[model samples]
Target: MTLDPPSTVSTTSRRGTATAATRVLGVLTIVMIGWLGVFGLLLSPADRDQGDAVRIMYVHVPSVWLAYLAFIVTALASAVHLFGKSHSMQADRVAGASAEIGVVFMAVTLVTGMLWGRITWGVYWQWDARLTTTALLFISYIGYLAVRGLEGSRSQRARRSAIVGLLAVLEVPLVHWSVRLWRSLHQEATVLGTDLDVSLDGLMLFSLFVGVVAFTLLFLWLLLHRSRVLTMIDLSAETGLDAALAQRRAEGGVTA
Candidate 1:
């Protein structure tokens, strides 16, 4: 059966997912992105070594960081859905939302990294440990999202995807540590390295920090809206199914 349009859905669903707080969050995300563009793209000083090529790191670093954070959130939400006392569908929704966002950011990380690599290393692609593991990480989450799209009851789909999510997330640590674990062309962490010493220039560091904060805010905003959208979609489908079943029973002269 086809799902009803949002306009035709029940009053509770009609209220939609937006709120004053979400509106404020959306506004804040926009403002932070604008600030990041100024500082990260324009104002930040170019690296003496990498020159203007280094500016891309402001976006690339934050994208990978947020991708990791999003996948971690997905795993946590999936765990809550599977093992928590309530086993709430809300957790499943959050897991799906976070996974989708993680995949998008992962794609961003790969594209930006390839561009930067071409500029610095004279190649758009490499078989380096970090790059190879990162490509695998991206493909794994794509599979996770595909699993979520499989046909089943909500709980069944959630359980299947949850298991995959937990398994898929194990790859994150491998991707993060690949540089150190193997002979890779990828550079080790700068700001978040083992040494704890910051190697970037003062203004560049601040701009990178802003990029992180801005992307974090954007992720939160997107996650909130996406999860609510998933909730409404499920609710609408269940409502439509119930209505169809009721009509079929009426036509068959059956009583509940």
Candidate 2:
């Protein structure tokens, strides 16, 4: 009978679920995002105010929404890691996965916002409160990703990363409310908001909603894959470290 090494153990039930979810989400993302593309780009009527430029909303809104969501997930998971003594590593992995994906989505948000801004605000760049806060938010999380790579013990690394993850999310609220709190060119939320409501009806509204949902599913799919890969990498590293320690002991005349 062939015996599998501990590091090469069969997949857990949790991993199987993540794999299945990734497959399902992949299909849904392709279909829904594709549908949104056609609907937003061609079928939906151009805005009377912004004309074709409004089409950027379908991509921009969803990307920023997911960016917020990703940070929230990271913060929540980080909280668990800090509090949950036994299950800390699992929480850390989820936080790391979601934070990495969040950075990508935040970058997309900045790029798309700039494109839309060029048409609406007459400039591709601005130092408005919301824009400035958002840029800071993006940079802060980039730092969080960087900190994760520094050399440290597992406990020390996890503790530091978890703290950084929580601290990074504090910027999210500031970014969200910056326009409302101060004067800015950026429009307030259409589907979400109180003081600055914009009218979006018919297919335009539907397309925006579909884009949000599609991007959310895409985030989940990406997070699952990323976390799984991280887990495998950690396992391999641990296995290698164990082998090295065992070799050192055996060479010193200790039991192999």
Each model's C-alpha lDDT? 0.89, 0.85
Write one digit per residue (lDDT tens) for candidate 2, span 1-256: 1111233343343433244446777899899989998888988899998999999999999999999999999999999999886757867888999999999999999999999999988999889898999999999999999988879987778889899999999999899988889998787767677745657868998889889988998987788777777776677689889999999999998986
Residue 236, candidate 2: how far off, in angstroms? 0.9
C-alpha TM-scores of all predictions: 0.93, 0.90
Candidate 1, residues 1-256, lDDT tens digits: the string is 1112234445465556666677898899899889989998899998887899998998999999999999999999999999998887888899999999999999999999999999999999989899999999999999999999999988899999999999999999999988878988999888987789998899999999999999999888888888878878887799899999999999999985
Over 4 Å off, model 1: 1-16
Cα deviation of 193, candidate 1, in Å: 0.9
In terms of lDDT, which candidate is strongest? Answer: 1
**What are the per-model numbers of colliding residue pairs?**
0, 0
Best by TM-score: 1
Error of 1 at 16 (Å): 4.2
Candidate 2 off by > 4 Å: 1-18, 195-198
As for candidate 1, its clashing pairs are none
